[model samples]
Target chain A: MNTMEAMLASLPDQYRWAADLTSPSLRAATGALVCGMGGSGIAGDVAGDVAAGAPVFVRKGYGIPGWAERLRPLVVAVSYSGNTEETLSGVEAADRAGLAIAAVSSGGALSRLARDHGWPLVEVPGGLQPRAAFGYLTGAVMRILESAGLVGETGLVEAATVTDELLGADLDGPGRRLADDLAEGLAGRITLIVASGSAAAAAYRWKTQINENAKSPAFTTTIPETDHNEIVGWSTLGSAIRRTVGVVALRDTHEPPRVAARFEPTLGRLSEGASLVGEVWAQGEHPLARIASLCVIGDMVSLRLARNAAVDPVPVEAIEVLKRELGET
Target chain B: MNTMEAMLASLPDQYRWAADLTSPSLRAATGALVCGMGGSGIAGDVAGDVAAGAPVFVRKGYGIPGWAERLRPLVVAVSYSGNTEETLSGVEAADRAGLAIAAVSSGGALSRLARDHGWPLVEVPGGLQPRAAFGYLTGAVMRILESAGLVGETGLVEAATVTDELLGADLDGPGRRLADDLAEGLAGRITLIVASGSAAAAAYRWKTQINENAKSPAFTTTIPETDHNEIVGWSTLGSAIRRTVGVVALRDTHEPPRVAARFEPTLGRLSEGASLVGEVWAQGEHPLARIASLCVIGDMVSLRLARNAAVDPVPVEAIEVLKRELGET
Candidate 1:
């Protein structure tokens, strides 16, 4: 199995470990901001989806939002390698602004800062790509928030069992079958993913996975927002777009009915004569299970696309090149 | 002048009328949510950019965020034609939740609902596509927020004069000269815009304009964040992307120094061998002028592109079809 699959299979353990983690007692705050970059940051987006009691936002930039000060939100600095410059800068800026701040990382300057400054820190296991280690990061964050009385533990225990079952049933299974079909339909084409609410996070994961894993062009739009603008692009681009596009709609049982209603009409309007149009509904009963279920299915599809393209799915040499170039600037 | 040019030239007047108009007093609220879709929703994004004391968010889904109950944010429903189903549904949901609600539209069920329910309504001018009425919508929303004491009236007055001057400048002038350069450099190529802060809004405007006006593929990514995932696309897709993609960076004097720091490193990392790489620095000293300045230049680029593609820059038949489809469903 590849690193991603292994990571997916081990999610239950990751969650258990994260929930058992110990950190300093966190101060109360009106809101929370997750300062992270790339895959590490996406965990925050998922947390924000269900963090209904307090405002939970992911800040991908160097500082908090302007209004963030008055709310005195809990700022969580997250970096997988604990080396992301943006998150580092954000933590320092938050500290300078006297905001309540915490850290989550494998190990690096962030851990050092947490130790020296007496901030609460969750030290996760090291040596994994930020993207592959999403389960650990997300679980740790929920626990971090729970420490401050912001989250609960009742919703996600069954996610791993459902995901593991779906992952194991690969011989003519629904998910693998869908993945195989998508591989054939979307090969060498630009993909557009439309999704809403909790499913929007899966849509983003699919887009980025397709881009990195298959080396293909992919874009994601949230509905009904895209219904307003991108639908116009479909009308104007016409045949050129239809010839090279694959449209995927990610649906969840928990989403508003309006989401499905909009999807049927949008697909009817734009998917005709296009390369492919498909849908994947959530698999399990739990919200986290359903969200992860859709994302794992997308992860498989991207892996299949990579296999078809004869490219390895695990390497991100391009990221290394960018880091080297960025180091100079 | 073409349809887009006429609309661009008229933005100043649109802002004036939107600002000067009177509406019913809106109830006080802690935060604000702009409930809109497509171009109308973009107005909320601009307001959020400048909303200092309180949090301003753009909601594009069927109902408000779950946390809205605790926040008790002001919900302002905006649909240019006054008939967006999502906005209509959202307003009803907002009302049912006992949230402070207002309306902005020309005339439709929303206006009627406002009148019947005694909600504040800002009647936008009719007979133009929603996207073309961004300035008026933005101004009206700002005014709506002002009435609720959520926004101060300190910035943005000079946007009209500066935009008017640029709109008036003819052949060989600074704005036109830049447009000519972009028109030549970007013809028949896919454009990818990289922008940050206030300029990010203009980047989105340019992206949608390019899609609808030129009927070509374009994507946008914010700075610092793109350094994480999209940089992998840049490295992996290298030659294929470079041969077809035009890269434009929208810069503003108001963007924090950290925003610029990320740009230099990212451009140094990604711009080599691309079809086009260029920058547009915002004009005028005020934030609104700079924001609108960058957007106006992008509008000019899209118009020039449409002229080259031999397509009319107005009318989106597909949107009408989707609405008709949704109405039946």
Candidate 2:
């Protein structure tokens, strides 16, 4: 396996360990904020979902939002290498604001800051690229939020164990077999990912991965919501464009009954011209595991799709150029 | 002036009056949720800026996010005619979730539901198109959220009063005169709206107006977050795309100094070939006026831009056709 595949292969086990290892922080925080860049920011997004009551805001840039200054949030700065400039800038802003601050990093400037300032830190294992460390970062954030009392403990240990078992059981085996199916179904087509509830995040991730990894344009919209607006847009597309569209439904057990009821009918309506693919996530003992499993599966599918497209799964030249022009270097 | 112009003319006064009338409502809510369709959604976007301690989520579709379902939130559903199917669906969902729900409508299913269900309802006068009821919808949602104990009362009364005075204020009135200048700067460009802190809401409103009224493609992003990822994307754009971009910075006094400080330098560095326009919203007596004025001004500029684009200011044909094809009629 290539590096990404190797990382993917080990992800389920690593994520379970990470989830079990980290302790939840105390929840006495007045407010909460997340500071990270790129894939690390995805952890914050998941954290925001799980800790919805904590007013979690993701800091992707050097400057904090104006209102953040007055809120005096509990800041969690995340960096895979512990040295991202944007994340460090957020840490500095938190310091200036006198906000309670923490750090999640392997070892870098952020780690040093955490050590020197005596701020609580979650030490992730180094070696993997930032994207490859997604499982670790996301699990760590969940542990911290849970410990902080920002979210209820949802039997995460059991969930992680179940996820580990599922991964070892070759759940992705089907996904790989399905890859050729997807390529055949999606050839010369635009993919639209439709997800509901918590699945919206995963759907968005899939869209991004498809765009970056598969080097194809993809759009994503949440269920019920898209049933109203975006669904309308698809029906109006000329037959030529309509024939070039594919719909992928990412379903999880957590979806409400009403959402499931709406899903089939909606998909049936849209499937008139577009190809439809349904990928159901395996159930886990914990919501965390279930979420992680789907995410990993998505990453794998996106990568395989890239292979089918005869494109490199990693390098995003357009995004790189955009970043370079933005003077991120 | 056409009906839209006449309605726009009256907005400043209406906003000021509504601000005073709804101060208590604005003061009570812990946070705000703005629910509406199309232009009405713009109200929530503007309110997001002025409402302290309230993170506003604008719901433009049929159902709320699954995370929202768990919150059992206080949601203000705005539908000018009180009959928008999407808003009605959202209202029904919120009601079923036992959320604190309110309605802003002239008369229709929403008003009837509010009345029959004993839900709080703000009756905006009918006759005007939803797009033309910007001031009323904006004022009403803010007031309701405030009344429900979701946000603070600061600037509520003052903003309303100032908006009233400005209604009669000439188009060339000092701050309002920039309509022409902004239009000129934005001509033949994809206007990107940027704001931080309390101004972020206004920036979003500006973008929507540019999309719906200007009938052109536009985008909005908040500061700090955009600086990290989106900033990098700018550098990758070819010269043709870069020159076709324009930046509109929405400023308010309430922004943190650090956030305000990063504005100029970030824009200078990020917008290489783009023209930039700055619109500063004067802190009026009420937060309502402070937000409404920016919204109204943006609407005017967008309408002018639409004229320049040689597109009708109303009627989204593509969207309409899409809805029809989906059997939404």
Candidate 3:
């Protein structure tokens, strides 16, 4: 298997190991404000879908939201490399607000900050691309929350089992089937992922993975909201433009009935002018497992698209150049 | 002038009337949760950028966020037509949470609900499309917050003056100039907007405007964050695909210095493969005015694109169809 494929295959092992890791100082809080960006940050989004009792909010910027201070939510700062500037800035902001803070990283500035400040830190394995290390990062995050009493242990254990079962299915099973369908449908087309409720986060993950792995432009719009504005745009699409678009609906069983009802008609409207339209249903009972199932397929599809286009999925040269220039600036 | 053009030009007058309107029942709260969808919901985002003291959180979903109950924020339900289902659901959620609630709409079910519940309602004039009434909606939202003591009266008053000054400049000035640039650069190419800090909301406004008014796909990515993953996508873009992408940077003076420094390198990287790369700086000193100026140009540009493409800027048939089908369901 290729590097991304191997990484995908290794997720169960990563999760198994990382799920057992926790920080000693971690404890329950009123709510959670997760701070990180890109691959490291996406776990916070996935965690929000499964986080029980306490509300979880993801911050993908330099600092926490203004309301976060008043909420006094536990600030969970996550950076896979432990050195992301934006995540560092966010942790500092949490410190200033006197909010409880935790850190999750391999061993970088974030870990150092955690040590210096005596904040709880959960360190995961390093040496993988941030995106490739998603399982480990998410595993560590869920463990932290579980340790804090925010997420119940039973639910997480069930989710981990479900995730393992889904990933361990036959080699040519659902994940491959969805990836095959996507590879054929999304070739040379910009992807438009329509999802709502918990699946919205997965749709965003699909968009970003397609962008980073396939090196293609993909956009996501949640339902009900998309029904209001973006649906209108489809009305005037020219055939040529439509031919360059591929629409995917990411569906979840947990969405409210009202949200679920709008998908069929919305998809019908979108399909009339697009190159292709397809649906991918979440697998497993647990929210985390279902979101994970959806994301794994997208990850596979992105890599397939990369292989099809003869592009390397590993090196993000533009990001490297940007970081280099940013260091100078 | 076209319908959208007339609406764009009349923003100053709309703001004048809306700024003076207030509801006496509104009072200060720990934070503000603004809920609505599409055009009406956008005001909440703009309000977030300018709101002082208390933080403003915009919800465009079916109900309030998971954390809103604990925040005990004042729920500002805004629906231009007063009948938006999502906004109604959100208000109900707010009521159940026993949080303070306020309403902004022209007239519809929302107004009736507000009257029945004795919730404070700031009623703006109806008739125009929701997007066209952005000034009225934003003004009402700002006024509601000001009256609630979440936002200061002086700052809002200053914002209004600055908005008027910026919008009242030379007829063929900055707004028109930027529109011309966008019309030239973005025509036929899918637009990609890059913005950060307070300007991110305006960038979203631009994306939705381009989608609905221009009937084209437009995507937005925030800075510092975009530098992480999205920048890499630009590296491997083939020339053919590159030619179909137009990149615009929506800039604000208020973005943190760290964020500001990354823009040049990011844009330089994006410019290498994009059809065209350009910058549109937000005008005026106040956050509200600056965001408004950026939005007005984008509004003008979307209309100009529609005129160029021989498409109508009004009447969203697809949205109407979805709503009708949803009702039948």
Best by TM-score: 3
Better of 2 and 3 by TM-score: 3
Cα lDDT of model 3 by residue, A258-299, tens digit: 899998988887776665558888877777878887888788
lDDT tens digits, residues A56-142, model 2?
667666645555665566788889888776788888877987878877898988889988998888899899867678778877777
Better of 1 and 3 by DockQ: 3
What does DockQ give for each predicted structure?
0.52, 0.15, 0.59
How far does residue B293 in candidate 3 sit from its true spot (Å)? 1.0
TM-score of 3: 0.95
- At residue A192, candidate 1 shows an lDDT of 79
Worst 10 residues of 2 chain B by lDDT: B22-31
**Stretches > 4 Å off in candidate 1:** A2-5, A19-29, A169-174, A238-243, A272-274, B19-29, B169-173, B238-244, B268-274
Give the lDDT of residue B65 in candidate 2: 46
Candidate 1 chain B: worst 10 consecutive residues by lDDT? B232-241
Candidate 3 stretches with Cα past 4 Å from truth are A22-24, A153-155, A169-172, B153-171
Best by lDDT: 3
For A146-259, candidate 1 gives per-residue lDDT tens digits of 777666662455666655665664323467788788778877666778787678777877877776677666778777776666665554444554656688888888776767
2 or 3, greater by DockQ: 3
For candidate 2, the per-residue lDDT at A271 reads 62
